[model samples]
Structure formats: structure tokens, C-alpha cells
Target: MSSSSSMNKYWIPHLDIHKKVITQELQFYLGPEATVRSFTRDGEDGFLITTPGACLTDEQIDDICVKSKEMWEKQAAARAAGAATRVLKRPLHQPVVISKAGASESTRRRRESRRSNETRSRRDERRRN
Candidate 1:
């Protein structure tokens, strides 16, 4: 028997058959809008960002491809712009203040006492060894 005998009119034509097969495969596996629905819908390129296996019409797929290309170009341009504005060199070290020149005496005494206690504990451990 001929393969076209039981096929529908849409399935008989080569172009239509291909589209229908793509549509069915996308729908069977990816649902609709096939891997192109996840993209932002704000511009002409939003449809290219869909999850993998999305089912969409041929026109929609074309639109997604076009938009994705545009987005890629824009992203490349932005990256180039940012790279142009960055500083290449950096200082090795930054100075840090140990203590304020005129801090309260009480706080300083408390910190010193805590440090002395820690030092004493370490010395006592060494003696035991």
C-alpha cells in the first residue's frame, strides 16, 4: 500500500507535512511554543527564551530566532561598553586604623584585660605540656 493512501491532505504535501510533523513533535514533547516561550515578550525577540521542546508555528519560530539574534547583539554591545568603563589597576593595600586617638579609657582597659586573660590561658596550657 502507498504511504500517502491513509494520510490526510495536510500530511501529503511536503512543506505542510514537515510543519505538521514539527508541530506534533513539539506538542507531543514540549507542549506549545516549543523552547521559545520562556523569553521576554517585550520585544520581537522574546520568544527565543522558551524552555526546550516548545511547540510553535513556523512564523513564531522565525520571530523567536530573529529576536534572539537581536538580543545577543545588544548583550554583546552592553558587555563591550561595561568593559570600556572599568578600572584596570588596583592598590595593593589599604591602611586601617587600629584605634581612635581619643576613645574612652574604660573601653581600652576592658579590651586589654580580655587580651591578657587569653594570653595567660595559652601560657598555662604550655606549662602543663
Candidate 2:
């Protein structure tokens, strides 16, 4: 049998796993001869999985790539859904009132009331002085 040192290294990017369960899953999928190693570079983590004599066939590689893409897409969709729910739950930071052509009746009434209050306050101030 060939030594472990003679095995070929295959680098798979963005395969960082913190959980032992995930590591076990990868190991199980990769088969017994494969050895998986993890590394971090420039704040990003990746995996370096080794196999003897190109153990993975082209079809296996294609399947792995497809599954990885599907997983990422699902994760992205979930995050987007969560963000949308959060946006719906939270109150508006700035309430926007959009009207076409002229102001609405309620808006006009509010402006008139504000003007009357300002006039009354000024008049009261003058009378006091």
C-alpha cells in the first residue's frame, strides 16, 4: 500500500466547518482513503482534502459542485426571506406621504392648524409683552 504522504491534495474553497458533525459528514462522503484538512487565509477559511490517485471521478466532482451551488442558493434565499420579514416587522424610520398633484385633505388640514397655532402663539406673546 502507498503511504499517506504520496496522496494528491485537492483544494476546495469556502469549505469551512466549525461543527464536528459537518466534518464527520464530509469525511463520510469523501470515503476512507480521503483526508480532509482545513485552513484560513486572509480571514477566509477553506479545505484541503486529499485522496490517493485521483479517487473522485468527473461525475462525482460535477455532482459535488451542483450540490454545493444548490446549498448556497438555499442559504441566500433563506437570508433574504429573513431580511424581508424583519423589514415588515420593524416600524418605518421615516414615514413618507406621497400625493399626486396637490396635498391630501388631511395634510392640508394639518398645515392650516399649524399656521393657526403659530399665529395664536405670536399674538399671545405680543399681548404678554
Assess each prediction's global lDDT (C-alpha) against the native: 0.48, 0.65
User: What's the lDDT for residue 125 in model 2?
Assistant: 100
Segments in model 1 whose C-alpha atoms lie over 4 Å from true places: 1-54, 88-129
| lDDT per residue (tens digit) for residues 1-129 in model 1 | 224333222111121222323333434444443332223333422223233332345674454455556666777999999899866566445456676756657789889999999999999999999
- Candidate 1, residue 41: the lDDT equals 37
Residue 72 displacement in candidate 1 (angstroms): 0.3
Candidate 2 at residue 100, lDDT? 52
Candidate 1 lDDT for residue 1: 24
- Which 10 consecutive residues of model 1 have the lowest summed lDDT? 8-17
Candidate 2, residues 34-89: lDDT per residue as tens digits? 76667665667776667675644556555566666666677899999898876544
